[model samples]
Target: MSPKMVPLERATAPAWRRRPAALLAIALAWPLARLSPHRLRGALEFLSRGAQPVTAAEAEDARNAILGLSVRHGGPRCLERSIAIALICRLSGGWPDWCTGVSTHPFEAHAWVEADGRAIGENPDEITHFFITMKVSVSS
Candidate 1:
């Protein structure tokens, strides 16, 4: 049987917090996305070293910030969004796990951030379909 997928709940943050975070994500995502995968992973690993885990609330807030920014700018692909989330988490004094993976059968690649082992803002089933090729843990 296929696993049930849970809908991600939107996180609420004060306008003051959301606005600035969204702006930062917008500013950083494009440049980061242009980088090659090796460089991007290295950059994320360097930035997230010794970082602490973000709370569930903080994870959600970062997810929302990325979404808001994506809407204003043209939508960024998953790698860009993941990079933005990781950097935003670092700025917030925590970091989530950043991951990149690909799926066969239908053939797709994706990137995402996870907090406490759960993929933030993603369908659990969709994430399960991908096998992770690279990951950067905040604590590493």
Candidate 2:
């Protein structure tokens, strides 16, 4: 069975029910964020191997669930937020593409998740603004 990627903020499921898992992923991702880019890429790719890809809606729901946990979860911690969401989905045998990139106009970096070729939880500007440096996709 696929991990039910319902938005904790919007779902009928009690907030407390998914809080621990989300917190765990977020906390774990915190340290992983410190890894060198090459190692971090390898780590995420290793962790997500054998997982099935989730639908864009499911991936967005997972991202939103993390966002629902805390206002602090989404904004500046884009790297960690994307990491945590991917980890959460992987733990349930669902994987989304975990990507990192940089935007040139003003020069900034960002990370995000995508599934079914759609960027989950990101605005159009974010999607086009960043040039992807790396992505962890499901193995064929």
Best-matching candidate per TM-score: 2
For candidate 2, write residues 14-37 as lDDT tens digits.
167767777778788889999999
Evaluated against the true structure, the overall lDDT of model 1 is 0.76
> lDDT for each of the candidates?
0.76, 0.79
TM-score of predicted structure 2: 0.84
Candidate 1 pairs with clashing backbones = none
TM-score of each: 0.82, 0.84
lDDT of 1 at 94: 91
- Give candidate 1's root-mean-square deviation (CA, Å): 5.0
Scored by Cα lDDT, where does model 2 land?
0.79
Q: Report the error of model 1 at residue 88, Å.
A: 1.1
